[model samples]
Target: MNSIRANPQAGLDIHMLDVQFIRDNLEAVKANCKNRNVTADVDRVVALDEQRRQILQQQQVHQHRQNEISKLIPKEKDKDKKQALIQEGRDLREKVAALENQVKEVEAELKTVLMTIPNMSHPDAPVGLTPADNKVISKVGEPKKFDFKPKDHVALAEALDIVDFEAGSSVAGQKFYFLKNEAVLLELALVQYAFGKLLEKGYTPIITPDVAKVDVLEGIGFMPRGPETQIYSLANTDLCLIATAEITLGGMHRDRIFDELDLPIKYVGMSHCFRTEAGAPGRDTRGLYRVHQFTKVEMFVFCTPDQSDGLHQELLAIEESIFQGLGLPYHVIDTCTGDLGGPAYRKFDIETWMPARGEAGEYGEVTSTSNCTDFQSRRLGIRFKSTKQKGTRFVHTLNGTAVAVSRALVAILENYQQADGSVVIPEALKRWVGRDVISRKGGISG
Candidate 1:
């Protein structure tokens, strides 16, 4: 890894630790951002931090004066002197209170500013502003050549009676849909298949909680219960519904330290994830491609820094294998620096070929995996010790999607449709779904 100074001009959110680290290795942070296309706002964040420290100094001076006056008032030699000391203490208390309020305000503003800064990108990340700029690293299984005009997932869903978009809209508004008949079964089959594979690969099975505390949510790098987020919050609770199993899984070990021997822990979790889809108002609102809520099997691992890179690739392989088993035409892309989220140092996404998307059938993202390194571990206080090391070090964390049931159903249903309006369930999932095919007669309507 190369080290470079972080550019103060680059738009990045830096904390106390980030500043200290950058100050010690400014060149490394800057070079990393340049390589990853990560924009860091070092100048602004650092200046505000400096302001915060200056405010603290003023506050400390006032507090010290108050403390000295407090001690003096009790032992004044004369009445006038004692009265003056008491008055001075009251005035000092007022000034200190006002300064404290200002400090709180500055701190809050600083937090908001810092939150906008993106994480440093990996050296290998492609540089671009949008998904269009994402570099395709690999393509697998040539896209199926179709002779007839292909129906989009929505049209095919209606024709096959496998999805209920209208009813879903009527009941839960747009972006909320119901998977009927084969679609439902396919969802179950996908989750089971993915979960079983994860188990075979030495991952512990867990069904995590769907709701998490606000602090836990923030600690895991998600905005806690906000309109700008894609997460839903309970009306009267401090908990917010998770956008993915990663939230709950990551929160599981919050404020805890792990034993040195347990340097690596892997978990496969199944959970009903909820998202408000706040920013994406109209995109992918037609069907299961984008929904307010969905079930997913998520893979999360905590390991020592030395093992993270290998584990990251392993997680990516598992995602690719699941897509391969489904027999869907897809491509893998290395996410760019500008597009990667706050927690991801590097990310890879699997986009399946969706016949309904574009003129020649565009790809739709099915799964993504991120190597967060120690960013999350530091915030969560999850550290592990090694026998050879003097003290514990923050562990690296990674998360990848094993199966997102709703979207997988979309991929399978659209890709497997027959000319006769029936669906052929993938052979790998037959035993789990208990049906080989879904034909029109079996899809009889009410």
Candidate 2:
């Protein structure tokens, strides 16, 4: 990796960091962004880059003249010549300082714009702006036919006395809820079941910190210290609540290099992730679909570039197996370029069929896997050394949602609803949940 060149590939537009590289391959960078569905202001990045370069050039010229004039002053014995050299050097210094100041301003502006630009889309990614544009590669199982009008999770939670949205809202504002009775047991069972399965698959189980430093958050591509985004920052510290376990796991190996043999270091991290939901104020506030804080089992992998592709697919398979074990109907969709996050090189989302969330029985995304090919590693300075390969190379990092317990609970409740307002648990999880269906075997009215 060239220190001066930020990845100036044909597909990547040059930013302040990659100005020199972008200057050499300007057309290629613009073309790549276009092909990747990255709607970057390529023209703006290019123009700012040129301005920064011109300012830098002007500063360099002034510094060179200043150096030459200083050397001449020592050789010139005449008073008038010495005075002239000193005056010339002073003028050069002033000009250089002004030009350097302009360069700094442009560089700062370039960073703000470049950081917001989305990563280039994978060539295979479909072209679309929203989830609606996502391509469904496979649809598994079928939506069950209901004999009666099924109550939504919110209604069922109230009717069955399994959740307390009112008390939660009263205490902690809306979108917060307490899982009561069977819902509590069900949540515990789900977390343990998912943890056991990942342990069986040789993943190192760890319950990570729910909060991290702002620098760590930024290293993982999250703007933790910003006010415009959805981060929950601490009052006086440089810390912020982590939006996902991925943030903690991503920071675990920061500024450290790994052995090549440890190439696919898999982690099964459980944490209570927090989000402010800044951009989404009213959306999904009805139930457990969206919330301020929720427990999650996240899967993160650190692998070499050659190993990332297969590892990404493997992570997706693990997510699918978990859903399949739950006996829920789901579809795997290839997320389009526009829908991918800033660090994701490619992404795949598994949307489960939910009958109550939206009109006409919609699907809700339960889990997603992303291949962030060396993007986060580069930012975090994580690398691996291979004996066969010459030097250390940045490892490709990937993250997958194993089970967001809340949303999975939402899907299971809504999709497996019985006519009597009870939810049937998947047969495979009966041993863990200790019940086949969530119902008051006695009565709803205590």
Candidate 3:
């Protein structure tokens, strides 16, 4: 339809704490909310949950009375008595309907409140509110000390004639760009290299849709249609351009039940990601560093709860290995509880060396891996069946960035810039990019 869309939702699908869990462990949930820096009305949710149960009980009572009256209506020999019983049954039916509606109202409100509670932080995760409190897990590959002045990626790219923000901004808007010459080749090579790496690690590679239904975005805990939302939603439509492949990949098994044999399903997804950049740090509208759109190679996994912790580490390890292969100076950060998003039970970030991030060189986030234990699965209704278990259990979900191509470009362009204004391609991606260096007059396009 060419018509304008209507009533797009501006709220988040965040806050998926278990109601029964909260009922049993109210203090713990409350404490977790405080640690995570979110408002969780634990007391109010508990109160409403209690009321919800009471309404259910009342419904049952009404239904039971209706059933009895229905039976009496058929059996009564006196016509007048039979008619009276029928009227009673009708009244009971109406009362039961009213009780059901009231119960729905209570449950809806309870659920809304309960959604404010986030996943509990991993006990090993540091307790803090921001990146400043994040603990450094490890630093890999020492930063190269240049004898000559090092040029930032922006300047190097311009000199090499590989990236054009001038053309991009004119056509689209700021933070959008055209990757020209070797830069374009480098982007493709990064994708191919990352895909090959994940394939070697036994992942099935796929290219996900750049757009997904709004509900799918919510299921993955990506709040859409908000002024502060990173997600870019289509107006009057049911879809939004994805900020990450995670939204589509995480929702793949939504409302599905997997058998125990398929206990682990790991996918390597590549997609062109779009974001409003509304959540960009410090409102900084700079280079490809804060872009409106970019290509990403992401890894997503659906596994049994017992398997997710190991998988989480494996994902992070893969991310670390990728940057290491590129020879970028980087470090692993154990994300603090308060900084962990609503869906993340535990998270780790990899920050790579950026020679010209600010006034001086600093580490900036390049990749993130999260173990969203049953948070997405519960809301998405993705579960697994075990013969040993009588009922299904929600699967644990995990996502890791394999290569955020734009940032990888940033690291490469800056880190590999020769004193002569040339940039050497990462050895691992050379074959696919078909080049060893991007230099002025390098014999490709001008």
Candidate 4:
């Protein structure tokens, strides 16, 4: 629980909430913690803040006394009197310095505790703790009905020689694989398709760095260092492998101010995301369904507070459009309070139906969009001001997965598999992947 960072500038992004906000809304913040099932000690922030303030006051008093003594020493003619005054001034300076250090310790402790608290949930979000409690907003496309005994992505990949997990494990480790032949082409197609769609929607595309500073990861609500972190850390360094494009893209605008006319800046970032997959040992780990590394196209937005909800929906719509373009069946769910983790005021998840998830087919989460509502912007110090506005306000931030190349491949391979063992490509990927089918043999050759 003691996560006080040792870095001198540790609190920059992680401590964006005003201490005054915690002081004034103690009960509400506590209520939010209860709703989200988080264990943040709200009372601790208040108590430590009081101590910080007291230390500040003591330092100020000591400073004033030192100033007075220095002034009086200049006029005193007696050598003993002047010397004593100078000693007193030196002692006061030491006392002030000690108090200042105490203030820093108290403030740092306070910030660590405050950042543990989750953002306030949207009032419209349903109250629940599990998947069953999530509200089904709508089902996008109807589930596929197959005449053939459809095989999962694993079997299809084996048949077509599109993935090499055994070779991957020998080289890297488990949950790592080489996307061979058609799969590699499919990965690129998904990236290009998602990027093309997002670009058409006025989103600026960027290829983000795969690694980020630990603080930038923390600012975007990811734990870069911890017992239960999904992040991969470098030895004796502040850098960690990013889990998504969200981290680098969000960090790009850190400590930046924007004009209101430039409000709602949309970015589509592509990156090779890495995660430890630390505790993810479950049924979902069959194939590309869960992995340590994957290519992803992520959507990030920075808009005014009033624009967040609408932009969130727009992000969702784009996700649906991409899936629909690929002719995949999926459903949208309004994520519940307990499931909505830190930084998201509200969240929507898109689950695409995979024909071989279980005995029968099941839905697996493919993409998710969240209305972060200044939670990340505050942490990163991103603000916007309008000509009609007085002061700059934190711009709301949102992020959505345009395409997770691996999972999209799973959906594509299983759904488009032919009885003859060849896999028909989705129309969306036809252009990039060239000919329509991935043949039963090695490569996608004529």
Best by lDDT: 4
**Listing every candidate in turn, what is its Cα RMSD in Å to the true structure after a full C-alpha superposition?**
6.0, 5.2, 5.0, 3.3
Clashes of each: 20, 1, 3, 0
lDDT of 4 by residue, 216-307 (tens): 88888887776889999988999999999999999999878899898889999999999888777674667888899999999999999999
Taken over the whole model, the C-alpha lDDT of each candidate is 0.79, 0.80, 0.85, 0.87
Name the TM-score of candidate 4. 0.92
Put down candidate 2 lDDT per residue, 1-446, tens digits, no spaces.
21132432211222322445555666765665664566667567778877877777777777878889988998999999899889988888888777767766776678777665555457788877666788999988998778888677889878878889999989988777788887877777788888888888899999999999886787678887567667888899988988899999988998777999987999999999888888897798788889888889999999989888899889999999899988889999898866887788899999998888787678899999999887777667788998988977878899999999889888889988899888888776678777777775623233
Please write out the lDDT profile of model 3 over residues 1-446, one tens digit for every residue. 00011111222222266667787888888888898889878899889877877877787777778878877776789999888888888888888778777876776687677666788778898999877889999999887888887888888989989999999999998889999999889999999989999999999999999999987887788778545888887888999999999999998778788997887999999999998877566654667787989999999999999999999999999999899988899999999999998899999999998887776788988999999998888778788999999988889999999999998899999999888999888899899878788889895743
Candidate 4 steric clashes: 0
How do the residues 136-159 of candidate 1 rate in per-residue lDDT, one tens digit apiece?
A: 999998777766666777887777
Worst 10 residues of 1 by lDDT: 1-10
Provide TM-scores for the models: 0.83, 0.82, 0.93, 0.92
Off by over 4 Å in 1: 1-17, 27-40, 51-106, 225-227, 443-446
User: Looking at candidate 4, what is the lDDT of residue 177?
Assistant: 94
Look at candidate 2 and tell me the lDDT of residue 318.
90
What ranking of all candidate models by lDDT puts the best one first?
A: 4, 3, 2, 1
